[model samples]
Every structure is written in structure tokens, then in C-alpha cells.
Target: MLTTRLPTKVEPYRLASSGKCLEGVIPLADMPRVVEAIGVQESDVRISLTFDIDSQRRSFIEGSISFEASLLCQRCLRPTEPEPLSSDFRLGLVTSDALAAQLPGEYEPVVVENEQLDLLSVIEDEVLLVLPQVVYHEEADCAVSRDQLASGVEPEASDAPAVNPFSVLRTLKDKH
Candidate 1:
């Protein structure tokens, strides 16, 4: 989870080439927007992050994130477990003066202070970025109900039973 308390206090520096950090699974209950965004139930949430910091002028933070989640299919409204979600991106830590020069227009620059970085915020951003906009299940596994298909009646077919007018006339004469 990456965060910024004070933008100015963050000092810019190169990242360490290698490091290992792990955060326990965060409870997904309070984060309703995030859960809805990912289309996953709060119970199935899991996140694991691994990162490597580069030693360049502006060291690059490279990492892979994996998530185990379940989402509802859009068409059939069935629960689906997609292949484990994973994504990779770089974190560019820079100072106020060199912020624009170091970070390109496309890359998101995270401001750092006092040569310290918040690990949690970084992980959060990465997680959100990896989620797909729309969630859906495979067609073969979808669970649409069969009854819904049988209810639509064809316009040309009338529901009333056929009766002969001549038979009715003969029956009336016999009765008289």
C-alpha cells in the first residue's frame, strides 16, 4: 500500500536493486468500491506483491502482483474465477525539482520524501491498475436458466383451439 503523508518531506533517491517485502491479506469488507470495481466478493480477496528496486539515477521499481478473486458473469450472473490476476508496472520516485524531467508523460511519478517510501500505497495502486473494467464468465460455464427461453410465444400462432362452423349448424338443426 503506497501513500504520501507530506509531498515536500519526501527526498528523491535511487531504489535498492533487490528487496523482499510482504503484506498480509488486507480485509476487503470496508473497501466496497474496490470490491465492486473488481467484481469480486470480499471473501475471495488475496494479494501478493514482490518488487525489485533499481539503482539508476531514478531507480525503477519493478514488481509482479498476483490476486485470487471471483467475479460475477455479466450475462448469466454466475460466479466465475478468472485465471489468477497479475500485473507489472514501474514506480518512478522523484523530487519536486526533477519530477517533470525525470518522469515521462506516460509514467506516473510517485513523490517521495526524506528518502523514505510508503510500501502499502505502492501496492494498492498496482492492484487497482490490474483489474479489468468488465467481468464475465466463459460461455460454456455460464448458468442461464432454461425456462426463460420457452416463454416467448410466436406471433403467427394463435392459442385458441380450432372449431368447425358447419358442425355447430348441423347440431343446432338436430336439436330443433
Candidate 2:
């Protein structure tokens, strides 16, 4: 895939009869947390986009994306290489003035231009959206038991006092 940086001018911005689109890889290993959490075994991003003018009033481009990323196994905290998933989305672009009038205050807008498409931003969003909330390690020869305690000792705690914090608070309140 092409680098994450946006090109000088995205094709969609220009008032051209036809616009060209690009697709390529973006190296996200720079994000340490993302790399550590989602250990990518093998990843490739595929993007298909088109830019066109809509009735001389608005410019628009549609993007369809598919990518593969690995998730760390939850059981052993190891990397689980899963197949890539695809995401389909579209972005709308308008001038700052138009956006101020039409878009919500909290909404983010993508800008289209004369030469290239801002594919990197879209890819980042897609990856972020698809990342699983919890990554689980597959059950291979390396499954860790949930019952096992970290101290390597049985979880039976009989040598403890039967005092409760709430009870102490109640006694203090009564004394006052």
C-alpha cells in the first residue's frame, strides 16, 4: 500500500471529468500499543475508491476497504493470526463553509482534492473500528487454565479475620 501521508492533491478535488484512485499498504507498527495489543502476523490493506462531482454543488468519493490484522491471544497473551476482514464505508467532502453549515459540530469531515485520495486516514479508521475489544488466543497446545492462580497456591483462604469495614463504620457512627 502507499504511505500514510496524504499526497499533495487528491484527484477528487479537481473539477475533472474523471478521477483516479489509489490503493496500498500503510505501516502501522509505529503505534506501539496497537502493535502490542494486535500483534499483526500478516496484514495487507486493499482499498477501492472513486471520485466524482455531484451536480456541481458537491464533491464526493466512496471508499471500499478490506484488510487483515492479527490479534493477540487472550489465554496466553500470544499473537493469534486471524484472517483479514473487509470494511466498506464512504466519506463525504465539502468546503469549510459548507461543512460549517451542514455538518455537526462534533462530526469529522474528509476533504477531497485534485490528485490523490486521503486513503491513509480511511484505512486507519477501518482498522480501528475492526479491532476486537478482546483478543483471545486460540486453543492449541498452549491454553492456560483460568482456575490457576498467579501465586501458584490454592484459592482457599481460611486464615483470615471475619471483620468487615462496614461494621467498623457502623460502630464509629453509633459512638458519635
Give the per-residue Cα lDDT of candidate 1 at 120. 50
The models' CA-based lDDT, in order, is 0.55, 0.58
Query: How much lDDT does candidate 1 score?
Result: 0.55
Write one digit per residue (lDDT tens) for candidate 1, span 130-163: 7766776655566764554366866797789877
Lowest lDDT 10-mer window, candidate 1? 3-12
Superposed by TM-score, candidate 2 places the C-alpha of residue 157 at a distance from the truth, in angstroms, of 16
Q: Candidate 1: TM-score?
A: 0.53
For residue 142, model 1's alpha carbon misses the true position, in angstroms, by 2.0
Candidate 2 Cα RMSD after full superposition onto the native fold (Å): 5.9
Supply candidate 1's per-residue lDDT for 169: 85
Q: Pick the candidate with the highest TM-score.
A: 2
Highest lDDT scorer: 2
Q: What tens digits encode model 2's per-residue C-alpha lDDT throughout 87-146?
A: 666555655556736744333366444445555555666667767788765444346755
